[model samples]
Target: MGEPVRSLPHLVGRRLSRVVVLIAVILSGLLLGAGIEAQEADNSTANLPTDAESAVAARVQERLGTAEFTPAIVVFDRGGDALTDEDRDVVQRKLSELQELAAPGQQVFPVLAEDGQAAFVGVPISAETPEEELAEPVAALRDAAAEGLPEGLRAQVTGGPAFIVDLSQVFDGADVRLLAVTASVVALLLLLTYRSPWLWLVPLSVVGVADQVAVQVVAAATQVFGFSTDGASVGITSVLVFGAGTNYALLLIARYREELRLVEDRYDAMRRAVDRAAPAILASSGTVVLALLCLGLADNPTSRNIGFGGALGIATAVGYALLVLPAAMTCFGRGLFWPFVPRVGDADPTRSGLWARVGHAVTARPVVVAVAGTLVILVCAGPALGVKVGLSETEQFRAEPEAVTGQLVLAEHFPAGSSQPTTVIVATEDRDRVESGVARVQGVQRVESAGEGEGSAVLSVVLDAEPASADAFAVIEEIRAVAAQQSPGALVGGPDAEALDASDAAARDQLLIIPLILVVVTLVLLVLLRSVVAAAILVLTVVATYGASLGASWVAFRTFFDFPALDLSVPLLGFLFLVALGVDYNIFLITRAKEEAEEHETKEAIATALAVTGGVITSAGVLLAAVFTVLGVLPLITLTQIGVIVGFGVLLDTLLVRSVLVPALVTLLGRRFWWPGRLSHDGRHDGRHDGRQGSPAGHVAD
Candidate 1:
């Protein structure tokens, strides 16, 4: 029989009152944290970070110290187009008006280019000005320019803030739709799984708190550290914070219910539940935070910012789960599972019937189950090898009217790669020679001669492809080689080439970090479960699922999105989510499986564990997927990619990893499902065996 609940005296509610007091202190601290940042208007957009903007800022700072510069509209007209004296006078007056309108960093420098075909206008973006504050100024300038434009002349505003604002308008509604669809699917799954109002209500309730806490923490961090958040990071953080936080909460709650059957007192049961699940929760959260932390390897500030924000979110989730959850459970007591099918003082049905039958069948034919499950995984995985990660910010605005108009305007007047590229700046002992040398780079399709200063000149070379493309990087290398041979002193720096270098380095970093995380996670599993083989198997499964998910994403995006493939970050992000969340599920299932097997046969244990935990995980996965799907509706390519990839991964984890792969693998392993552990033979009854028979070789719990 199972050991008495009190037999493991050390594991009981030791210092329960103190733990409760600690939770109270934490909740108070979190509340105090909330008040640290005064509530403001719902300027949610302003809270979003802009890594691209940060990249541009870094470049500008390098070029011209930390001094401010205003974004301006450059007007162009055909040469020799005679302007009436009145029109010329009007233009002159408007220029002065714009100059007078300038404020600190918000100044305008209006200039008509010497060719008369183009004019440059500069407007300073104030250091203190938030994004929303610039709209009126931008609109006023556009209206002023449009009103002053002579017939057949066109004016274009190309500046940092203007572009970001335009892009934001395009992506406005995208995230909402995706969020709605994802939430619906998750709620449906939850309803099916628990069929309990309390279960559904708990996740939804905790998700709100999680979302608020993450955003507030992120914003506060950025403010304190003087760091900036990009638009892409904001949406991705929201989904991750919500999905992962809710998943952790579910793990704790589900474990609590399971432990309920084995213990008499409600508080005592919760204490056991916390002790059993806390280590797994801590380990899983660590893996996720570590994966995100690894993103700091990228030189890209965007990825770094995401890593910071994401790490913060995961940390917050862990703290909240450990402290807040237990307190809430204690406060609610039995009512926590009330108005639902409470398992209070009752035997769980998982030990017998359908669960038992399936368990018995699996043990009887482990090879068949394992082989069939492998076949299914292989089928799903075959299409995944072609997965691609290509992202374009323009795609996020496809559903927006303003974005459509802006994109059309841009396409008509600009090359597809006009928005970005590697610019090779040539400076040499002899500037004339540098220009001539830069002109010879093979892949460079166009070169504009800039700054004919004494003994100095700059060459702006535009390549044939997007600057971030690998082909573009190759071109940069060739150009650098040519420059070295000819004008060796030239500094080649631009978004494209820099991004390529950063991307390559990040790729290598991910390779190193993936294995590191695996090892660490595996170690955690080994220590917690006391089974080396089980930990290895779980880790291997998670890694395989990641690869398969990536492959499938490549196919989906390539065929349907008509985009290139996936982003450079897909692999790392996929691994992070898959491994961390995958392990979370593993802990829930394997721990329960071990509990059952310790008192019964391996098959019976597997069956009972599946019945008890399978439905909850499936529901959690659905909810998590739904949360990610909301990102697909976001008007940004980055968010959409994250949503699709993470959503795909969660579904795969649920249906494949949890439902079939794990069960099949365990069955095949059989008696060795636990290699260095022995089954309990005592007739002492834990609630699991109250109404059920142990396997033939074992005595049932009394």
Candidate 2:
């Protein structure tokens, strides 16, 4: 009687404190959103590493006052026939109008191709200028080219400046689209999972706000760190927050709902839910955050920034879900659940669970389940053998942009690399020899001096193949070797050389980052599970899931979508996401199994874990997979490939690997699964279990 009397005030105080914390979290979020302005991430910083030869040449050119030049090529053609007299007049007229739109020193004129079928002018724009400043003049040129065109003769803008504008144009409004699609998908899934209008709103509202806050946080981080970022990386990060954050919410809410049935007081129920959910949430989020931070080691500026952005975004999501979400949920009390409010002594939701049946089937035949899963993974891996890498500049877009069309047209009428030639920089004394040597290289159409600086000169070398092509990349290498032999300090730098260097950098990043990611994930799993056997199995299954996703996505890309080659960034980015995120579902599953194992036999605990967790984990998995699919809307091949690969990988983890393989392994291994852990030694441990408690059998229904 004295104890009850004493605890009453403490209970009331605890509830009041929760309300205060809830209000603070909400107020803090609003302040964060309103206080910080979103600065667009800077992606124009060179994509290449500073130490790359192309980057070196760029520095020399900057010193020579020529680094700012980004030529916009204006192509005029009359289709199959040579340029007519009227077409030539229209070209000359347009060039005259374009001259007024150019920067102060830019010269605007057209030189006819040797075939007399087309003509182009390389109008200079400063690459160093802000995108907004560059866009104004470029828009004027495009607008001017569109009007006053002779009926048959059409003008199209292609080249470095035009393509850069095209890239920016497609990415316009991408974030809003991704947010809408992701929100819609999550909302629909929540409705289906909860079967209540009001309950869906809680997690959705919480996750929605978290996503916006994360974006702002990432934007702030980008400004603070000065890391390179693009629309694609930012969009991808937002998707991750919504997907992973909602997943965390689902896991917590499911546990909370399960607890609500066992307790009458909403606060006590929530306390139990948080106590159980927080460890698994922390472990999984920590693994993802740590793995993402490893991307800071990547050479590509975009990958590195994603590392920072993803980490910040996940941290924001986890903070809000674990802290703010619980408070908001309890504040609503049982009323928020509507018709399905969980009552004290209510029927266990999992009594008729579908996942329990799956467990039964698996436990009855673990060997068959294991063998079949392995065979499926192996079969899916076949298409990966034919996977290609490298997409040329024009091929970067999903739906061809105007610039790609114009570039293709330019290739038809002029030297393939005429519009965007490679620039070789060398000392003035070495320029002649470098040019002679470069011109003599196979596939080199032309090489000539462009400009001279204090001690350096620039040579524009046109290739027979389109820039960013295998043929053109080879030519770049040959030119570099020849130029270096002729002049020791000669350097090759241009769009083609930059692409070559970017590809090589991605390869090196893969070699170093992949191994580190594996080790990091392994260590996290080992520490969390306290079992080498469990950690190794989880890591191996995740690796298999990654390989299977790649193989499957590559086949689909080739057979259905007709993608020529996977982008160089695709493999590492896919691996980074697939392996790290692939383990997320497993962490949720095995952690629950371990908790159940403390009170039951190993096989029964796994089955019970599967039954209780199956619904929420599946919902989380599907939601995550769908949110990543939102990347397809961006129309960048790289982003789409990422979406497809990660999307498939997550489904594999959720549906096949985590759902089927990991469980069977655990059931078969039994006590050995927890080997060396204290649980393994005793086969039991102390936990809170009361006569009034609900059983794992309660979860089979959900």
Task: For candidate 2, write residues 1-702 as lDDT tens digits.
Answer: 000111112221247647755675677667565666445544443357879999888788878877667778888887768888988878787777888776678787577888999898768777677775666777777888889787888888877777777888877888888889989999999999899988999899888888888877776776687774678778878988999999999998998888889888888777667767777788889889999999899998778878888999999999888877877787777878877888999887675679889877877788899999999998998888888898888898989977888888788888898877788988899888788888889999998888988988899888998778889889999999998898888889888899999989988999999999999999998888888888899999999988898999999998898899999889998998888888888888888787677566677778887888888899998988898988999889999999999999999888888878888899899878887776565434323332232233221110
Candidate 1: C-alpha RMSD after superposition: 7.0
For model 2, what is the error of residue 685's alpha carbon versus the real structure, in angstroms, after optimal superposition? Answer: 7.9
Clashing pairs in 2: 349-701, 350-698, 350-699, 350-700, 350-701, 353-700
Candidate 2: segments with Cα more than 4 A from true spot: 1-26, 29-46, 681-702
Reference-based lDDT, residue 101, model 1: 47
Each candidate's root-mean-square deviation in Å?
7.0, 4.3
The residue ranges of model 1 lying beyond 4 angstroms of the native Cα positions read: 1-137, 141-161, 167-193, 196-199, 219-228, 259-264, 333-345, 352-361, 392-422, 426-428, 443-449, 452-457, 463-471, 673-702
| Tens-digit lDDT track of model 1 for 411-483 | 3343434433344444435556655665676667666653333343445566765435666677777777776
Q: TM-scores for all candidates? A: 0.76, 0.93
* RMSD to native, candidate 2: 4.3
Model 2 clash tally, residue pairs = 6
